[model samples]
Structure formats: structure tokens, C-alpha cells
Target chain A: MKAAIFEHAGKMVVEDVAKPQIQAPDDVLIKVIRTCVCGSDLWSYKEGDHKQAHSMNDGHEALGIIEEVGEGITDLKVGDFVIAPFTHGCGQCAGCKDGFDGTCDNHPAPTNWGGGYQAQYIRFHYANWALIKVPGKPEDYSEEMMKSLLTLADVMATGYHAAFCARVKKGDKVVVIGDGAVGQSAVIAAKMMGASRIVLMSRHEDRQKLALESGATDIVEERGEEGIAKVREILGGPADAALECVGKQAAFEQAVGVLRSGGRLGYVGVPHEDNLNLWELFSHNIQVAGGSASVTTHVKNVLLDAVLKGEINPGRVFTQTYSLDEIDQAYKDMADRKTIKSYVIVD
Target chain B: MKAAIFEHAGKMVVEDVAKPQIQAPDDVLIKVIRTCVCGSDLWSYKEGDHKQAHSMNDGHEALGIIEEVGEGITDLKVGDFVIAPFTHGCGQCAGCKDGFDGTCDNHPAPTNWGGGYQAQYIRFHYANWALIKVPGKPEDYSEEMMKSLLTLADVMATGYHAAFCARVKKGDKVVVIGDGAVGQSAVIAAKMMGASRIVLMSRHEDRQKLALESGATDIVEERGEEGIAKVREILGGPADAALECVGKQAAFEQAVGVLRSGGRLGYVGVPHEDNLNLWELFSHNIQVAGGSASVTTHVKNVLLDAVLKGEINPGRVFTQTYSLDEIDQAYKDMADRKTIKSYVIVD
Candidate 1:
């Protein structure tokens, strides 16, 4: 099986790797259909440090067809199409029951699916809890629809989690920071959650267009204080809620600055800063929420319906596509900021 | 008139001074019946530096008789018993209307009541909005009850604000990180909100007793990791919500450490650290909230009912009282941690 491996910093190679096998009763084997590059992967790719090098499988998002299932799996069957969340969890744990699968207690060790999804086939643990079965036949959906479904595996679900954490409500003035895929998805999520006004802070025209199409009513292209100033001018004051999709310090600060006193901020960005000025949050009575999303079966199920109904087209975030052999180019284009997100198709 | 003045960093004197006059249309002159030393005041007191000297009247919390009212003040009358919140706001601003007086946009230039409350007479700005009428004659209530009403001016209201910001739901396991007046009040607030279990982190036996009396079901006497360890041992895991009442880094860290994954924290401490590790909060899916409490009339009114009904006794936090002449001793005792809180009676 050809799989993407992190060979060294800034480099990835598709080489023949042993296919995954089901070791647990709840395990299921899936043939990868589609996967993509996430912004977070750039952290290790850009660092180029040996200690940060990851030899394990690369991707955390994938939509695939079930090839085999272990005896413990009662709900899912072979030949079914399913989407896997970035993190896997045992459905029976207290944490999982409470809808925080990211911190599932039963599978205490690293429980992410054994083989990365950017491959010919992958082994998934806790099949029933970790996998969301897509209802329709794979051949019935168009290529764009398929890509949209693939987003439910990570980015779309994560964006929705941000909105959920921020408690985005109807009539809320929402400010979304970042123009990346997740940020675009957040624009769509904020709209879906009935936010009255959506503001996207982006410097790029292309991403800004996508942001508008995704439901942003306004855009603040300026960076830093200028960006905050522009947003304030547009909203007349700070927004009621802010969704921070870029995990950088400046982006977080901007998000905080654009929120009204007592407003809530939901952040899903992988933070690059070690410290946050809590005093700022304290003085303004702001609430900060959102972390590594634990998109439970509930969130996936709701998003799956929205995708099938064509209510949202998150797949537009994938600006380019590549084959398994062109994995290097796929990552390079994403890391170079040439693409919002790049997709990899495998069979 | 005699008033407490911060002459030097560590010294205070009760000397003859001009009585405060009503400067604004909404200003009201009040005969301060009770004023208490706050933990936050210790910041300046302990600094003992010439640069930190504040010659203004030395207290924020006070419950007194309304001696006079400006033309604009319609609701409050002379002889009415009232308590003033530490921060004042014009009731008309968007922030104030929305119940966040701390960030009120109008009348924004250092709107804290002009001269502090540790005096025979104090001038209060935004009198109608900042002062909560205690709804009875001063002579009608007992001294202890009057002291408890004074708590509504700052400590009790702040504690309630923490609980409100943390969204303490019924049956929640709450952890309070400080055992001072505000922390003790948080214990009472959590119980009032129907928290199933309340844990107080305190080293002093007296504070622990007050904590238990105030509604804390458990106490962790150790500090730092050891304190967290003791709490974990008791709870078997993290708590559902945590209240950070102490502003130091260690206290904040301990509060964060004790919250369960996806738990919420409300903090009232004046943060001493410039930075907070958002990474820790993000990884655990924790939500952080709280600010300088802007106790609106609504909150004060509700708390006033609780106090009048004998449902809560926040005044117990004040262990000692001093006359205006002994104001210096009051500050020293509180600064040395000899008393949980000190009160000053001026007539």
C-alpha cells in the first residue's frame, strides 16, 4: 500500500508501507477515498527540526469505504462509506458519553486511528464511535459533494465546534479571524447558527471572496490594529461574538479586541503563543472558549444532513487536488500559501 | 470632617479634611456608616513606595446613609441607606444597559466615586446607578446585618459575579481557589446557585472554618501541585467549575488545573501575570471568564433580598472593626494577614 510518511522536516514521501490490520474487536479497515492538507501540518513542515519530525502517518481527515470490520462492530458493515474524526474515542467512556471524545478516558493512550488516512487503506479503532457513516452511495455524489463530505472529518466539524463553544446565537454580530479553510467554514457555521451579521478579517482577495460566499456580510482586510479599527468601523462597536480560527497571538488579540464587553470568543486555532494576557479578558468580562474540537457523533450527524441537503458547500475550500504520488507538491502548495487547502485522492 | 488618607505607601492617617461635595448632577453625598479594607487594596499598601501613594479617601466598599442627592438623582433620597459598588457607570450607556458597568462608554473618565469611602462623608458619582438603596432605615438593621450589606458593595457581588460568569449550573462540583473574603463569598454564592459540592483551597484554619460555614463541603490545605493533588484525591478528578479569587499566577494555575476537561472558570482576582498559557486552556477545552465585577442594580437587589432574608451572611468575612482614628491599625492588620478583612465605622 502506498502511504504518505513524514521522512524529514519539510519533506514527505509516498512509499510502499504495510497495510493496517485490525487488532481490536472494535477496529475497522477502510480504503481511503479522499484526504487533504490541514494548516496545522505546516507547524512541523516549516520547523524542519529533527525533534519535530514525525515518521507516523500524516493526515487526520479522511472519507473512505469500509473494507473489513471486526466482530465487536455491530452497527457498521463492510462496503459502507464513512468519515473519521481527527481524534478517535471509545464510545463507552465517560468522556465520550459526555460528548468530549477528544479526552476519552477508556482509550487513555494515543487513540488516533493507527494508520494515517492519506494512504491506500487505514485501520480505525473504536469503529462505531469514531466513524460517521455517510448515508448515500459513493457513486451518486458528485466530486464536489464528495469533497464537502470529506470536510466533516475535521475542518467543518471544527468550525462548527467553535461556533458552538462561543454560543453563537441568532442576531449576534460575529467576527471571524483568519481566511483559511477553517475560517471559511466558521463563516458558514456562524451563518448556519443564525448570526445576524458576519465579519471576516482577511487580507487576501481570493479568501475574502470565499468568505463572503460562505456568508460573511463584511470584510476587514487590514492587519493588527488597523484590522481591528476597520472592524469597529463596520460594526459601529465591538462584535457580540468572535471566532478565532488563526491560532497566532496577533489573531487572538484582534479577536479579543473586536468583541464587546461581556462577549464570548470561541477559538479553534492551534495556539503558537505560550502566554495570553488574561487581564485584558478580565477587565472586559470576556469569555474565551474552544479548544481541540471533540466533534461528537451529534455534531457530525447534523453537519452530514446539511452537506447532503446542499445547505453548505465547504468543499470550495479545496482549491487544488493531487494524486498519492504528488503528496509532496500538495503539501508544498499549502505550505507556500498558494492554496487554501489541497486534496489527495486515493483508492 | 476626618477621613483616612494614604499619606505614604505603608502609612494611613485619619486627619481633618474637607468633606466631599457633589460635583455632578447625579452625585450624592453619603454619610459612610461602614467601610472595609479589601485584599486588592493590599497591592498598594504592601508596595510601601512613595510613587504608589494615594492620598484620596482609602476605601471602596461602603454602606452609608444618603446625606444629600443632586438634582438629577430622583430615585434615591436623603437618609436612605445605600451601598456603592466599587466602579460606577452612567446607567444610560450601552454597556451599562447591558449590565456591564465596568466597560460603560459614557462618563468613562475614571468614573469610580471621586473620593473613596473611608471618611465621614463621601461623594458618589452616578449615584442612582452606582448606589443600591438597602431598602430600610439604618437604625432598623443590626450592625452585623449592616456589615453584610456593605459586602454587597464589593466582595459578595464580586463572588456572585464569578459564579455567574462561570455559569455554575445545578449539581456542579465547584472549586474556589482563594479563601479570603471574596473566596468565602464565592462558596456561599456557589451553594446559593445549587452547586452539589464546593471545595475551598485554603491553608488557614480560620479561613477553612469560615469556608465550611459559608458552604464549602471540602478543603484542600496544600498549595500548588500538592493542593491540586489533594483536590484530585478528594474528587477523583477535576471539578466542573473553578473560581479564581486570588490574582497570583500560582492561584490561577491551580484553579485551571482543578477544572475538568471542558470545565469553565470564572476569575475575579486582579491578574499579576501579563500572560496566560492559552495552550493549556485550548488543549483541555476549558472556558475562562470573569472581570472586574460590574454589579448592576439587579444583582445587588437580588443579593439584598438574600441578605435581608438571612439566607446568607457575607459579613462574617469581616473579623474585626476599627474606628476612624484606628484606620492605620486596620490597614496594618489586614496587610499582615492578621484578619481576613477589617471594617471601619465612621459617623
Candidate 2:
């Protein structure tokens, strides 16, 4: 198998490697169909040649078809298309039983993800519960549509889980900070969950458009004080709920700033450099912190329904899709914001 | 009229003062029946009080009877008993509309009560909404029971509201930090709301006994490291909900340490200091701060139900009471913790 290998720091090269095989009775071999980059990927991508740790493929979001199933795999068989979360849960940890499958100890990510910018394949443990079978393609899932659903395994599912964990309910006025794919997906999720109005803060044009189309009723371009005030102006005060999607200091501040008394703030964006203000959150009585997206628990059912109802067009987030050979250009196009999201088509 | 005047630092004496009369059309003249000392009252009591704003009478919790009602007051007439919160809302403030009448603009305390201890009567605004009518008191109520109900005007109500706001449900394992009147009240509230297990933390045997009698199934006498470990041992892990009843540093830490992954911590204890570590909260996905107790919104109903059913005896909380002439004794009893709470009979 030809796989993208991180030969050394600051470099990745396409090289011939042994194809991934089912090592356990519960493992399933998935033929990579499509995958995209995650923000976490940028951490290594930024470290660029100075550290060590990358041993296997780097990416976590991928949609593929099962090529072979271990004897223990019962729910899925060869040829069934599936969306796989970055890691699979064994479906027995107390956490996994309660829908937090991502935190389960089963089949922890092998310490050998040498490179994420790869195009090959990987086998999953406890494949039945981890690999969600993508039933017959949604009524009209063209290649582009499938690429969009591909994100459901990571970004979309994350956005949705953030809101769900925060307990956002119908008639809520929600404020979403950051206009990335996850932020855009949150707007759609908030709307689908019956929020009366969704306010998104975005200065990026392409991301802003996606937010609007996904159900954002109000869009503000302010960053800090002005941004919070704008949200207050639009919601008539602070919002009933807020989703923090940008893992930046400014976005987290803005997310907490515009909440009404008793309002909840669901934060999914991982903090990188800033310290959270306990005084602000504690005194103001805000409930904060919802963890990462639980895509494994959601990707399958959500995609099937979206495909059936035509309610959401996940593939529209991809502004460009390239062959495995165009990976570098894909990264650059995405980093520069020239594309809402870039996808890599794998066969 | 004679009043308990806080004329200067460390000085409070009974002095002649003007009688209160109705001002607004909905105002009511209350001949205070019982007023209790609160920890907040000690803010001035400990400061050795130089009359704040050239005024005295620092008490914020009181229960009494209606001596007179303004023309617009229809809910009560002369001789009706009532419970009043410290701050009186005009019943029209946005805070009042949202059931957070604690921040009401007009306030419920007497105008003559600009600062310090007092013995006269009070003038209440929007009497109908500002005053809660106590119902079905036993024919001969114990002075202690009356004082306990008086504390409900503040601490007890605050505690109950905190528990309710945190959404403590049936079968939930609840842990309460702080054995003050508020924390004790929270134990009762969580139990009333159907929590299957309640843990109360307190070093004082008296407070722990109160907790056990009220409803707490377990008591953790340890603090810091030992306290947290004991709590986990009792509940088998973090509790489902933690009612933070002590505002002090140690109490806050204990509260945060004893919650399940998706647990909620309702903080009602007013922090005597502001230092905090929000990252601790954010890391575990703990939902902190259920907002200040909206006691005014539930006081009337709680008083009526508890008194009518005899299911709860809030009055046991008051261990001491004094006449208007001996206000100093009441304060001393509370200061020494010789009394869980003390009430001053003002009539």
C-alpha cells in the first residue's frame, strides 16, 4: 500500500508501506474513502521537524468502506460504507455506555500515528459499535456530498455534541463564536434542536456564509467588547446558550462575555494559550465546559437522516477536493482560508 | 419609636427613632416579629461599624406581621404574618420578572435601615410580591422554629434555591459543602427533592448532627484531602450534584472535588474572597454555578408547605433568641457559634 509517511520532522513523503490488516478477531479493515485535517493536526504540522512522536498516519476523520471483517465483527461486513471516529470505543466502559464513547479505553489510538497527512488504511478494534454503517447513500450523495458527510465523524459531530452536552433546548437564543466547519455545524445543530435564533460571530467571509446557510439568524463581526455588545444588541440581552468553537483566547472570552444570568456556555474548542477566568465564570453563575465531539455516537444516524430528509447537505462545506497527490496544496488552500474546507479523495 | 441603633464602630444601643409609615400605594407597614443574624450581617458586626452612610440597622432577614397596608395593597390586611427578603423588588424590575427578586431596586428592608442594627418597624414596597405570608403555624410556635423560618428569609431559602437550580433529581447522590444554615437547608432541600443520598461536610459535631437529623445520610468531618477522599468513599465516586454552601476557600475546593464527570455544582455560598481556579472546572466538564438562590420566588410556597405538612421543622435551626432590648446577646451567641442562629424579637 502507498501511504503518506512523515519520514522526519517538517516533512511527509508518499511511500510504499504494508497495507493495514485486521490484527484481532474484533478488528475490521477499512478501505480509506475520504479524510480531512483537524485543528489538532496543526499542532504537529506547526512543530515542523523539531520533535518526535509521529509514527503512524496523522488524520483522525475518515469515511471508508469495510474491505474485510474479523470473525468477531457481526454488525458490519465487506463493502459496507462507514464513517469512523478518530478512535473506537469497546462499547463497555461506563463512559462508553453513556454516549461518551470517545473516552473509552478500548483500542486507544496506537502511539504510532507517525503522520496524519496519509492516504492508506487502518483497522479498528471492536469494529461493530465503532464503525457506523452508512446505509444506502443518501438519496443523492454525489462525491461532493459524501465528502461533506465525511466531516460528520469529527467536526459536525463535535459541534452537535457540544450543544447537546450544554443542554440547549427549543426556543433558546444561541450565540456561536468561530465560523469554522465545527462552528457552522453548531449553527445547524442549534437550529435543528429548535433554537429560536442562532447568532454567529465570524469575520471570515466563506465561513460566515456557511454559518448563515446553516441557520445563523444574526452574524456579528466584532472581536471582543464590541462583539459581545453586538450579541447583546441582537439577542435583546445575553444569549440563552453559547457555543465556543474557536480555541483562541479572544473567542473563549467572547463566548463567556455574552451570557444572561443562568445561561450555559458550551465550549468545544480546546484552549491553547490562555488561562480561563474563574472569577468571571464563578461570580456570574455560568455553567461551562462540554468536551469534544462524540462523533462515533452520532455520525451514522445523523448522516442517514440527513441523507434521507435532505435536511442538511454536509458536503457543501468542502470548497475543494483533491487527489492524494495534491495534499500539500490542500493544506495551503485551507490554511489561507481560500477554501471553507479542503478534502482529500482516497481510493 | 425606639430602635437598635448602630451609631458607631462596636456600638449598637436601643434608641428612640421615628415610626415607619406606608409610602407607596402598595406599601405595607411591618411590625417586625423576628429578625435573625446572618453571616453577612457580621460584615459590619466584625468591622466594628462606623454607621454606613450615616445609618444603622444592618439586619437583612426578618419575619413579622402587617400593621398597616397601603390603599393598593389587597393581598394582605392588618395582622397578617409575612416573610420578607433583604432586597425588595418593585415586582417590575427585569430581575423580578425573571424570579430573581433578590436584586430588586426598591428593596424590602426598612428605609430607616440605611445601615446597622435596628428595632423599629419597616416600610415595604410592592407588599403583595415582596412579602410572603406564613401559613398554618402551630398554635404555639416555639421561638426557635420562628427564628428558623426567619433565617429562611435569606440563608435557608438561598440554600434550597441552589439545590433546586442545580436540578438535583430523584436518586441523585448529593454532596453539600459548608454546614452553615444555608448548607443545612440545602441538605433538607435536596432530600425533599428526592435525592437518594446526601452527604454533608462539617467539622462541628452540632452542625453534622443537624445535617443527619434534617436528611443527610452521610457526614464528612474531614477537610481538604481527607474530606474529598471520604466523600468519594461514601458515594463510591463523585456525587451527581454538589451544593457549594460555604463561600470560604476550603469549602469551594471541597465542592469542586466531589462531583461526577457530568455532575453539577450549585454555588450559593457568598465567597468571602475571590481567588479561584476555573481550569479545574473546565477540565472535568463540571457544570458550575447554578446562579444565586432565587429564594423570593419560592419562599412563600416552601413556608406554607413545610408549616402545613409538619413534614419539615425549619425552626430547629434557631438555637437562641433575644428581646429587642438585648440585641447584643443575639449577636454574641451567633459570633460564638453557641447558636446555629439567633433571632431578635422586635415586637
Compared with the true structure, what per-residue lDDT tens digits does model 2 show for residues B234-303?
A: 8877677889877777877888787754567787776655655544554444666644455567676564
Task: Report, for every candidate in turn, its global Cα lDDT versus the true structure.
Answer: 0.83, 0.71
For each candidate, report its DockQ versus the true two-chain complex: 0.56, 0.23
What tens-digit string does per-residue lDDT give for candidate 2 at A1-347?
Answer: 76665444445456677887788898888888788766555555556524454355467777777889999988888988787776566676544555655544333553211134256677766788777777764344677568667877677787787787667899988999878777887888888889998999989877777788878999999889999989989888777788988777788788888875456788777656446655466544566756545566666546447644668766677888877666656665676677777788876
Per-residue CA lDDT of candidate 1, range A1-347, in tens? 98888877778888898989998899899988888888877677677534335475458888889999999999899999888777776766545665666556466553333337788888888887778898867888999999899888888888887887899999899999988999999999999999989999887889999988889999888888888889889988878899999899898999988887678899999888867888788777788997877765545657888989999999999999999888889989998889999998886
Q: Give per-residue lDDT, candidate 1, residue B158.
A: 87
| lDDT, model 2, position A340 | 71
Q: Which stretches of candidate 1 lie over 4 Å from their true place?
A: A49-54, A70-72, A91-98, A105-115, B49-51, B105-115
How high is the lDDT of residue A5 in model 1?
82
TM-score of 2: 0.83
RMSD for all candidates, in order, please.
Answer: 2.4, 4.8
